[model samples]
Target: MEINEVQKWIKSYYGQRGWTDYGPFIRVGFLMEETGEVARAVRSYEIGRDRPDESTPPPEQLKNDLIEEIGDVLGNIALLADLYGITLEEAFTAHKEKLVKRFNS
Candidate 1:
C-alpha cells in the first residue's frame, strides 16, 4: 500500500480502539526507545565481529537482532508520521530534495 493509505489505515485502526491522537512526547519516547534497540543491536554485532575467535553469539542471531531493531525503528517512524499527519513518502521526498539541493549548491 501507499504511504498515505497506510497512514489512513493506522488512523482508522487507532480511532476504532478509542485512541484519537498520540502526543509529541509519546512519539518521541517511542522513537528514542527504538533508537536504543538499534544501538544495542549494533553494539552486539560489533562485539561479535571483534571477537570472532572467542565465544561469541552466532552470526544469524546478530542479523536477526539487527533486523528486528530496524523494524522497531520503522514502526516508531510510522507512528510519528501518523501523529503529525505526514506521509512517509512525503517525508522521504522532502529529505531527498533537501539533500540534493544542499549538494548541488
Candidate 2:
C-alpha cells in the first residue's frame, strides 16, 4: 500500500478513538517505544536470546515477530509524520534525492 493510504488509515484509526489531538511529545514516545520493540525483535531473530527460561520460539515465529514489530515501527513513524504535517511520500522523495546525490556525485 502507498504511504499516503497508510497515513490516512492511521489518521482514521486514531481519530476514531479521539487520538488526533495527541501532542508530538507523546507521539515521539510511542515511536521510540516501537523502535525498541523492533530492536528486541531483531536481536531475538538474528542473534537468538540467552534466555533459557523460555524455549526459543520456532524460526517462523521469530520471523513473524520481526515482521510485526517492524510494522509497528512503521505505523508509529507514519503517526509522527502525520502529526508533523509531513507526508511519507515527501519524506521518501527527499531521502531518495539525498541518496542519489551522495552516491552519484
Candidate 3:
C-alpha cells in the first residue's frame, strides 16, 4: 500500500503482460488519457451529464467510476515515474518541500 509497493506492482503487472515497451512520450499519452477520464468523472460528479438518450448512472455508480478513474490516473503516473527510475515517495517529498518553501516563506 506504499507508493513503492504500488510502483513495483504496476511494473510487474504490466511487465508480465509485456506492456512495458512504451516510450516516455507514449506513457505521457496514456497518462493524459487517464487524466481526461478523471476530468470526465469529476464533471459527472459536479454536474449531471445531459444525455437523454442514455440513462444516467446512479450516484453510487458515478462515485465508483470516479474512484476507478482516479486509480487509473494514479497507476499511469506511477508507471511513468517508474519508467524514469523515480519513486512516487520521492516525488511527493520534493513536492511537499516545494510547497513548504513557497508558502512558509
Instruction: Point to the candidate with the largest lDDT.
Output: 3
- After aligning candidate 1 to the native by TM-score, how far in Å is the CA of 51 from where it should be? 11
Judge candidate 2 at residue 97 and give its lDDT: 100
For all candidates in order, the CA lDDT equals 0.78, 0.88, 0.90
- Give, for candidate 2, the lowest lDDT window spanning 10 residues: 14-23
lDDT of 3 by residue, 1-105 (tens): 888998899889988987778888998999999999999988888797778886788999999999999998888898889888899999999999999999999
Overall local distance difference test of candidate 3 = 0.90
Candidate 2, number of clashes: 0
- The worst-scoring run of ten residues by lDDT in candidate 1 lies at 47-56
Per-prediction TM-score:
0.74, 0.92, 0.95
Write candidate 2's Cα lDDT for 1-105 as tens digits: 888999899889978988767788988888889889989988988888988797789999999999999888887788888877899999999999999999999
lDDT of 1 by residue, 1-105 (tens): 787677677567667875536687887887798899899789888764466575667889888989989867776677778777788889999999999999988
Residue 65, candidate 3: how far off, in angstroms?
0.4
Rank candidates by TM-score, best first.
Answer: 3, 2, 1
